[model samples]
Target: MAFTLSIPRKRISASPGQIVTALIIALFLAVFLLIPTGTVIYTAFTEKGTGALTAINFIDFFNTELFRRSFFNSVYVAGMSVVWATVIALPLAVLTTRFDFRGSMIIQTLGFIPLIMPPFVGAVAMQLLFGRNGTVNLLLNDWFGFRIPFMEGLNGVIFVQSLHYFPFILINLSASLRNIDRSMEEAAQNLGSSGFRLFRRIVFPLAMPGYLAGASLVFVKVFDDLATPLLLNVKDMLAPQAYLRVTSVGLTDPMGYVIAVILIVVSIFAMWLSAVAMRGKDYSTVQRGGGGLTKRKLTKRESLVAYATVGFILLLVLSPHIGLLLLSFATVWSYSPLPDGYTVAHYTRVFGESSLYIKNTLIYVSLAGLIDVIVGSAIAYLVLRTKLIGRRWLDWAATSALAIPGVVLGIGYLRTFYNIPLPDGTPLATLWVMLVLALAIRRLPYALRACYAALQQVSISLEEAAENLGATKQRTIRRIVLPLMTGGLLAGFVTSFATAAVELSATLMLIQSNSDAPIAYGLYVFMQSPAGRGPGAALGVIAVILVGLCTFLSHYVIERRQKTLGAAK
Candidate 1:
């Protein structure tokens, strides 16, 4: 018996309400995201005094030795970070997915720890633990008679970024591995393929999409990062050079805009390369009545080696958090493997003196998260439920924020709003709320995807039934749609809030005064001087806790919701 189940495909013009809703979102993107980004691109290509289109800026960029070096250095650092991140992520992904490994769940969960802390927050801690005169080198000199330059120059940035971002690969690759059809593997085995040859020939090729997705992300993130390089005191990178040129030489300098344009180009290039690699290649292998790859059992020796390997990688990745905690409590920690003494004074000082930073961060991030969810939910609804004209453009515009570097967005906001004034004669750009808007814009894509996924899981039949019962679109969404989407909206908010709390690049440019600064900006300021390192470490701990809690909350909500949905079914 053949069962042909056909679903109707139809496109209807949007209702007036949907058109209005889309227009509102379009306006928001145009003003905040599109225009500012366009301004930066325009500034980069135009002649400074004449406002005419010219290629002189780029020609001069290539001609200058320092600028040329910065460009190549950025590329090299980003590329190396991807390589090292893969090295760290690939093994864990395979071990957990391919074998019946003990503590597999624990290892996967711990990988999220590095992401909660910003790369630059860990930069100083890494230096203390790995620098030439630092603890590791001191111990190595005493014991092994030689030291590795783990925290030297550009190596430091690469090390910090790879450790911080490998989870992207681990997560995506693991999901891909879990979805691979076992039938293909069994067929490959029947054909005499086994071991590394089996993995290379059959398994890895199927997972290439996932690997490239993660690797591209790592490359783009490292390339766009500003604070990590600056904190490491490696100033010859493109992002740092852009920041320095704008702040030190003043925004009127053409070099900053030029570098920002180049950053955008390289980012787009990396994504394009990943896409081109996966082009015209079908990776869909899961078939009916077939399951994912079968797990293999490891022998005692293999288990021991696997545990040992996983333990070493975890220690290396978690070192920053460990070092930060020690530094926060330490009275003095230098030229030693551990702190000399510990105290609670750093936390005391943070609460008493720098409490405003925390408060501001909470307020700003909350508002940003709220904005993201509202806007994201609306976009998702419009796209999925309505046949609104140009609805896809809203999705494209929002997701475009991902390609933009934080430093570039900061520069864009400054240029676009610097001269505009409020009722009190203050420049509109100087307002604290602008920082919130930037955060919202920077994180909208994440929230949008979450909401989109949530909305997709909702049956259109439910909404249709409500409409048939005489309910309005707005009323149906408010009563029927929103309640069903609570889980996803909450997840989206948590994600936006967690990541936004640690953002520094955009905040750096948007912050007009110390009073308005968030924790990330405050951390950057405190870490600049030796005397403030303890308090800075304390704030960093607070940030880690804040992001960690949000992450845990997201997971709990998602799991609880899933259980609830299952029970209802």
Candidate 2:
């Protein structure tokens, strides 16, 4: 009667494919991410001459007045940019999602235009419009005998970065606003809460998660940005300092490694702060019927103000594109309210001379996009569908790339792979394949998040039904899951490709010959020379068009898919 019952042990297992997929992901992250990052960190701490551990590098970085100024300047710019971006974004989010108004969609579309154009590409145009002798300053001097120094030093950097990155906050906040349950707002109103009070207490708090996510991203991006600050001659920033130190002082410079370490540390710390802020917050809505926050029709005065406000903001945001277009075609644009003359010669010159850059961009970006989709899909499946151990770590490893500044990654690649030779006897850093790999690694997180979200919307029963019918897990995924996730996959691929095409910092370092440079580097080079500005602007226009087209196409695909699903239901 006292005999213990025999118990069977349950085994946790993953299929061979899942195991293989996990292994591939692990290896990919380890080689491209972990190894390079670890190498950078290791180099940062070691003495260059003796190869011994030392704190001298950090001490030097901290003690240098220039480095200290750069650090504080970066922090100030990042902090101010977040505040300005939030100010611009929050109102737009409220106007668009909370109030029904004419041209709301148009406002949203214009908001996204800034994100499409890379900050550096827009910096030159911004300078032309906002510089001391440029159009706006000239106009102010002529009309009012007064001028604004909007494009002066770090001020210019912050202005350009805020305009460029505000879309992050806008998009995230708008989505969060749309998802908020109407009942919460109604309940607050019923309890005498109204207007800003309601928003501050209920709506804004609920949307805090999304706002923080976007804000942290903006902070990281502005903090680590290299090209914009460099283009604006704001070289005292952390990223530019890192780049200058490495390039000017050579790879043996410990100060360069020190700056790189600081960049990584600050970026990771910002991201961690964002996550910590959202932890244990119950922002979830109880709505299960697919209803969201209710929108109100704006009154006549409110509608007029809303339209005017949106129009003014759109004009400011779109000024860089306008300046770029004018600059591209201008025969002589200096110190003038408008171009002295216009022609298509710049476009022709870009196409005729920099055609290789364009072609290389297409090849590398497409390959990178493909790589992103495949890897993203595998990681998503492993993390979401399989019970594979340590799968979540894969997600974290891939995403950690976001916290890594491109300059840091580029230096890592150089130091880690400089000696490795390719089959053609050239160093791996010189190979175009390295560019592809860098772009892929840089952009994988975006694709992975998109694919993971798409997979989460899919039900487990579909795979179970397939398996119940004797289909292998691989076959089930191929037949059912892949088809279902096509929209997300294509969206992710387009996003990855678009963003990669405009990548500069990593591309700047890894590109070996002029023949191998992408359009971003081409633009950077063109902007460096006064005579090359027109052609560079022309190239910038082309880049913007390519990204805009891809973005619209992705939206179309997602919408069409949703319609198809709805029709079937």
Candidate 3:
């Protein structure tokens, strides 16, 4: 007879634990991340006293001469930095991935040296080495009768940023080049495509995604950077303007919020453009034998040229580090090729008087890293292991922090929390704990990716086996899953800790007392005065060493774990 009407059953894939965990994460993201960000946007659009929606702020932003110049300067510096960074990176990537170059490992390893030290930390060092009266220029003037404006005005900012950030492009482009299918290159070669023509037509287009990704990152980083411009005394840029407006003009000023909004928009646009550029450009290929581009042997002339180019780039890249080490021990270094004299006194002064900065940094970053890995692991588990509703939003919320400049986050936190008083009557925003929270929020995405990758590598069958053996989800996660994810969690911790140790942007706004200042804030403070430069440089060297050691140890640990796991299997 007649068929009965039937309704589809809803899938109830998440357990109560998963649901509760998801709610907790959502609550944290909402209160800490979403509210602070929304507060900035709300302030940017609304009038100061009336609290009514208005476009006057944005109108003022576009109309003001200073704001207009800052806007253009930011764009120009970001664009040129990306260009120069690409110029520096492209040769290295092509040389290493395509040719059997000597000491390629050393070149690649040294390429990453800039990443450990923040651009701002090296800003003074760069100035000392490349300034008009500094080392390189002095030598050039003595020999060649001319000076390069390498550290003059906006040029200084661009130089420091390009050197610090080219590694991003280098890393991404090199990886992309290495992964390229050799078959396509062979096909191009069969069609008479060779050398530069082959690269332009075949290799680069296929690697465009990686280049775009890195370029976008560099653009966003340079655009959003506050300390580099400020340290270089090049304040005609959006980020420094935002920081100055808030710190000097006060948080109530509409200009800072406007700049913050512009920063966010530009960052999002860069990322979007990168994505759009990459759409429909997938060049992945399946092959029977070997993967990646085939390496070619460099001829005698080519080898000489490659080595010289790489050596020159490396020298320029490392000059800041060399200058820093020299500055740390110098009795006086002004307008000199080398220090007038050297001593361990600066390091002794740093340890004796500025030790609190180091201690605060250790505690704060340790807490922040711990928070990041815990939250990151939770989010990774919720998204990967369960079909929890709104789980993907958690990931999106955390990742959105990438687009928010640290200056904006600091402004948002100050605007949102300064009025809320603690039980002792101090404003909640002024507390040292807020510094740790900001660092955690800033570095959370990196930790989340590490945890997500680690979780992905843990076979689902292992979890299924645990569940089938009568273990609860929570029990299985703790006893089975977390043990396997240890490498990823540790990797995530070290990354968060290392990066957070040097983060000064958001903390600059939150730090209320010298006693509570972390290493980065302390470095900024020391670098501000002429007399403190030696101690500041010493502190920077310490930071570089700390980050470098952590990175090396993380790599070693992850590799050892992989080997052990492979052997057990």
Best by lDDT: 1
Off by over 4 Å in 3: 1-5, 288-290
For residue 46, model 2's alpha carbon misses the true position, in angstroms, by: 1.1
- The positional error of residue 139 in candidate 2, measured at the CA in angstroms, is 0.9
Over 1-569, each residue of candidate 1 has an lDDT whose tens digit, in order, gives 99999998766588888888899999999999999999999999989889899999999999999999999999999999999999999999999999999899999999868998999999899989998878889999999999999989999999999999999999999988988889999999999999999999999998888999999999999999999998888999999998999888987788899999999999999999999999999888768533778899999999999999999999999999998999999999877888899999999999999999999999999999999999999999988987777889999999999999999999999889988998889999889999999999999999999999989988999999999999998898999999999999999999999999999999988898999999999999999988899999999999999999999998898898889889989
lDDT of 2 by residue, 169-284 (tens): 99999888888988999999999998889989988998888899899989999999999998988998999998998888988998888999999999989999999988887888
Model 3 misses residue 389 by how many Å?
Answer: 1.2
Candidate 3 CA-lDDT value: 0.92
As for lDDT, the candidate ahead, 2 or 3, is 3
* lDDT at 531, model 3: 97
Question: Candidates sorted by TM-score, descending order?
Answer: 3, 1, 2
Candidate that would win on TM-score: 3
How much lDDT does each candidate structure score? 0.93, 0.90, 0.92
Show where candidate 2 strays beyond 4 Å: 1-12, 181-202, 279-281, 284-296, 423-425, 456-480
